[model samples]
Target: MRVHKFTFAALAVAAGLTLTACQSGEDGAAQGGASSAPPGSPAASAPASPGGGSSSGGTDQSGGKNSAGTGSDGKGTAAGAGSDGTGKAGKCRTGDLEITAIDSTVGGDSDGTVAVQLKNRGGQDCTLSEYAGVDLKTSAGSLSAKRTGEHPGPVVLKKGKAVSFGVTYPLNTSGGSGVRVTGLVVTPPDETKSVTLAWPGAATLPVTEGTGSPVKVGPIGSAGQGG
Candidate 1:
């Protein structure tokens, strides 16, 4: 009887030990799973959180860099546009003009007028807003013509177009007492360079920059126009 009881107790103790070992292994596995995701698991493969991981953070940084670059390019383009807006054609120069004495008196000498024409041979358009300065070349000295009209408005001289003005001088009708003019030196408005052109008509016994009133120059206009 005693031996049977002892055998039964030993069997029960062994069975209890096995049950405790199984329970301990199961608890350790559950704790490991709850603490962190294992490698190659679905949780480990998921994308990073908004503010945390390498993948999402790198993408956001790249987007920020692109936005900054775009802003810099936009500023440069705006500055270039401003610079181009201020670029306009300049005034006409003497080297760009073809100057000539077109017509003069046929018979009369006193109060005689000469038409001076200026054509733009410059490849581009230019502005001419005032009277041209004229000087009659003579044996005595150069005679400057006085402006006769009011202030003229601005006019654009397109390429290949022409503008004209009149030069009026008095003649000494007395015998051999008049100024003898050979040529003219014309200076365009607001220009420093000059152009020389020969007098269109007779050189002797007629032309004189007036003694009483100065020789008169009319405002700029089209051909056959002006005072």
Candidate 2:
């Protein structure tokens, strides 16, 4: 009976040692698997949060550079448009012109005609159109000419260029009493101011009262020659 009890105690001791060894081996294998994990593994990659910041920083830098480039281009385009002078220049003022008259003889019952010349003496270009308003003033009386139904084309005069028009009146061939004209008053197209030019003494402007003013005016044309 003593021998049997001793044998049972030894068997129990052996079984306890085997169980402890198996548990230690399993724990060591688990620790090794955790330590040897690759860097690309989900568990190992958790500390790569700074990589996301670097990616965002690169994108922001690119966007900022693109925005700056676009802004510079827009500014350059605006400046170019401003310098292009999209609006045209203004019309010429009355004070910037020169007016003159030349005596010309006409055919038929008409006595004579006066060629009025208008020159642009200003530094810029100008436009002139329609018939010139003309009135003959003398010591005897004042006589205004009737504008013809014909309309002249618009004439653009550059600096130092000129334009002209014609004025005609009937001759007093019957030797009746006629009014003598001393000076002529000319009003340019679209202008309110009047310019007075001295009539040439060589020519006479005969006017017959009550016969309806026989005076007639033509359209504006190229200067130095009448149209």
* Top of the candidates by TM-score: 1
Candidate 2: tens digits of C-alpha lDDT, residues 111-208: 57778888888877677777778888866677788888776567666778777888877665666555677898988888899999898533344545
For residue 222, model 1's alpha carbon misses the true position, in angstroms, by 6.3
Top lDDT prediction, candidate number: 1
Question: For each candidate, what is the lDDT?
Answer: 0.72, 0.70
Off by over 4 Å in 1: 1-88, 106-110, 202-213, 222-227
For model 1, the local distance difference test gives 0.72
Q: Encode model 1's per-residue lDDT on 34-65: one tens digit a residue.
A: 53678888667768676565353334454354
What TM-score against the true fold does each predicted structure earn?
A: 0.58, 0.57
For model 1, give the RMSD to the true fold: 8.0
